[model samples]
Target chain A: MSQFVMPSLGADMEDGTLVEQLVAPGDPVQRGDVIAAVETQKGAIEIEAFEDGFLDRWLVPLGAKVPVGTPLAMIRTGDPPATPDIPQPKDPAVPPPPPETPQPAEPDLPPAVPEDPPLAPEPPAPPPEKMGTSHRQRVTPAARRRAAQTGFDLSALGGDRVISLDDVPSAPTADAPKPLSAMRQAIAAAMARSKREIPHYYLSDTIDLTAAEAFIASRNADLPPDARLLIAVLFIRATARAAQSFPEFNGYFEEEHFSPSAAAHVGMAINLRGGGLVAPALLDANEGNLETLMMRLRDLVMRVRKGRFKARELAEPTITVTSLGDRGVAGITGVIFPPQVAIVGIGTPGWQPMVIDGQLVARRVANITLAADHRVSDGHRGARFLRSIIDHLQQPEAL
Target chain B: MNDKDIRALMIRQLGQIAPDVPFDTVDPDADLRDEFDIDSMDFLTLITALGKELGLSMPETDYDQMRSFVGLQRYLSSHVT
Candidate 1:
């Protein structure tokens, strides 16, 4: 028999929650078959089978929290072990069984004394003003310390009703700690490593969106309710096309070598309302048509907002894009997600005067910044990639 | 049932779930969630995998009690008997 253990999804993760079990005991599983779902710091991932065999035993139950490498279940390849008779151990050197006790004889005159015992009745105890007065209330240690530090009376705050300190705001202590949610911790580790390890080089370009906006307006007039394209969809499509032009930017860097990939898996940095971020991918952005890209982008954003994005959605991005359109930020530079060579940051569209064939005219322009790994991509290549995206935006009909 | 066998099985199982994870350096005491970012679904899959490998009956409710390596070891030890 072989045990299947919990897998560490990333470099920084230590533990994971077992969110769901896809397979049960006695099920035949093969290699790469998804057996269960795990919630990592990154996101929920499907745990795949390692060996082909019958699922013999489950070491841990579903929804159990487990450390890295903890045996989650087992598979039996050989013949099943025969059932062994586990002996119930007897107490060693046991004393002889206790002698049977003899019963006492009742007196024959007991009938004469039974009539005098019912003369007095006992008094009942009085009920207290409040119930559960002696019950201990649950409160954290921090709350206890806060109540001690401040003159605030916890008893008075909750009244004489078996007061609980939960409602009382705990004073922050030096050791006041809360477990980091699986997502937040993962984000912290990834961001910290990206800042520390990856050498980021940023390049910014202002693209005239005059044609793109007009093209969008024209398309929207005839588009279906769900097929209407947003500026983000246009940015993604144009970036995907630009990635094709600059193949070097659409790949990963590993072992000091740049591996250019054919697929343009575009990841979008989505800002969650409470201030965390998740970058779910629009896989194969170049393969889909305009309507498909629009629907996919919309779906990805909705999933991201609801925190229901799957692990595959966040992994294997060849390139990433982040936009601050709703924030009204004109332009901002960003760091690249490591392994992936480049990330494009999109800014809010603004009206700016531009020289159109030597004559000054008001035009809507969007600022796009590309941050690339300097070890893999040089300044010239990065600039050209940014320029190509701008060119695509300028001629929107071509995208 | 031996310790070495169990460790080897663990390494093999971990590799299957995370193909890129370096098994040789994995610390047993590390919280898989905090240290490696293993999520709930992955943990469940791991349990299912282990159940198939070890021939032990583990129910869903048992997962709630088995949060750490020691917890898992105790759970297996009890049930394997």
Candidate 2:
């Protein structure tokens, strides 16, 4: 028996609206079968089933948006015609199904926080303009000065005697921090969960990208503007190459077991407009050349922005590669999105002074960081994985 | 086409390429990339849209000349007619 859960498209994607159901509850699902269309900020994506089974029952209804890892349906294994796309892990070892018990509406999630928490009735404090004058005697001289500078709402202050400078926050709390969108709330929850549950260990490597830069210029020189490749494609390809070698870093961690993926399914993290981000998989990242990868990247990003992508592209990412992409940030430390054990963060590349061949010279370089789950791979192996990426990047022509 | 209408055409493409960035604050002389946080994919999409709209062939070698609004306008002005 297997539980069909909502795949984590990105660490940030918390929930998706179930817009359409492709398969009925009783349908026999082949591996990689499209079961439903989920509406994310990236728009509607058809989600696929990773396991082959007799679709037992629908735990979630159409139009219901649920958190990632929530069991949408239960799949009964064995006695089904095998339409093999992915090999089964436990076929001969299939034991009798556990005694039937009802699954929850959602699992591994705390009670949903109301979009807007109940507000206290009209702030028991004095009126706005009245505070500066009437409460002027109650506030300390320094506090008054500080509050004025920060535009802090003096009316919100309470208690008998006086407010101190320490009481005045540097920022104006009077102006409420913009309420996070539903997607933002989901991102916050997912990140908090990743930090709490995953024993994340990080390592960063500064690699000279001089060779990659030259390779890019030479390649783009004769091509059309529409066909030119960017440095990011190299980063994604290198990450895929590294994950191909370091299989431990390229699979989901669930139920206290670590299963290595045969091929690297690289998640290309795309930042959505306004806010939030989604990292959908680019299947078989290691198989393509730089030009091929660039074309694939272009098509994926274009579709994602338009809000149309296939479900397998959203679900099957075993490892994710996130790039700052010329934003010019020095480096980034990523959080391990469960159950994927590893994430590769590519920072902005810039020319910097470095010693090479016993001489100080300027070299194009970037700092790449790896955030991996320690439960699956140690920092030592993680270092080796990052090293492979760095080396692959140094030889951009080969990749 | 007049420069103003051409600017609008380019902006229309940018609006599709990066739907979030505000063109009101954009510096015409500054690189579109720096002004709009436009990356390679956005850059490609922009060229593709403008090329399709104006029926111009922009080779990769000429991309540097089209990095800014003033430069792009000059390039398009010379090439379009």
Candidate 3:
């Protein structure tokens, strides 16, 4: 028998809602068959089978949400169906026999006359014996008193039904109500863990965006509506390049080991207006040109904003970049979105005075704050990474 | 503000914080933080925008009570009145 469980579609997808079941029990299924549709943080995705067999049972029903690796269905290869035998009821007309025939009033016992003993016993119909009911089972003294005072029927309320003194429910108190959505709960857990476990170190620098801004404007003038450049795209591309320069930043932390990756998958923290955040990855971002990066970023932002992103998009990001320029934030330190070693926070663009060779000149500036896990990368390496990103942003034509 | 007015304000505030969020698909009673991924910064931005628009001082703790649209509407209605 083969088990069809919800596969780990991505590293970050821990659980999913069984949105729909495409096949039913007793159905013969083949390899690559779409058995069910599951919804993750990203969106609805179909789950497929890996081998051919007869689907024996549907362990999880439609609308039943389950964790990743939970068995959703089972399949058996060329197995015969087993039939269960049914039991017939006995005739109700026949009456059951008398349990034991009154156990034949024990033989060899003699009957005695009651006249001799009755006289002495009668002398003391001992003043009506006081009913001293010592509780045999364990119960609270308070409960006993309450039962005595209120005449609460002890027989009806006692035994296993009565909670122990230590197990009694306490008085009700108000608790902060929490949201029930699994996705939101998971996000809270991840963020809380990230904030708590990751030892963060921040490095901030002002990038001269004069040339980049002009380049973006000129490019936007000739581009279509969907292909226009946003400051975030440039930030994403630069961050990706920076990650390549400092591979230590693009990696996941495991038990006593820092596994640095070769690929530069950038997770962009896209803000949703109502009240949450989603960081979707722009995969192979370092290898993409400005146009491709811009297009992919545009598509991702749009899809994320509309809540149409797939589960795959939220996983395996080597690094992350969150821009607050649109919301008018000049600069803010972002917490390292964990497992990933670094996050780049982009501030609103403005003009700042800087020295060029021997003369002071005003230039367009944007503060970029890089928050890295200190355990994985140090301050010197972080500075170098930031400088590389600044270099890329300054030289837009080369990016 | 009335309930309708509060909803409109929330939708507008949402747009400002997350220009890409789909307002029409959201449940008014759904937690803004949970459903839309609004972070603390976004929450602050929304409160600031709403404070400026309503000309009222709203406290940070007030956000805790304003989870859903109905909840926010009720809060605004009670406090504004």
Which structure is stronger by DockQ: 2 or 3? 2
The number of the candidate with the highest DockQ is: 2
Q: What fraction of the native alpha-carbon contacts across the interface, defined at 8 angstroms, is recovered by model 1?
A: 0.00
State, as a TM-score between 0 and 1, how close model 2 is to the true structure. 0.71
Per-residue error (Å), model 2, residue A128: 25
Candidate 3 structure, TM-score to reference: 0.58
lDDT of 1 by residue, A141-209 (tens): 555545554333455554434334565554322232333544565666676777887788888989888
By lDDT, the best candidate is 2
Clashing pairs in 2: none
Q: Report how far off residue A287 is in candidate 1 (Å).
A: 0.9
How many Å off is the CA of A262 in candidate 3? 2.1
- What value of lDDT does candidate 1 attain over all alpha carbons? 0.67
Error of 3 at A239 (Å): 1.2
Name model 3 segments beyond 4 Å from true.
A1-13, A21-37, A40-59, A71-184, B1-81
The DockQ-derived docking category for candidate 3 is incorrect
1 versus 3: better lDDT goes to: 3
Report the C-alpha displacement of residue A304, candidate 1, in angstroms: 1.8
* Weakest lDDT window of 10 consecutive positions for candidate 1 chain A: A103-112
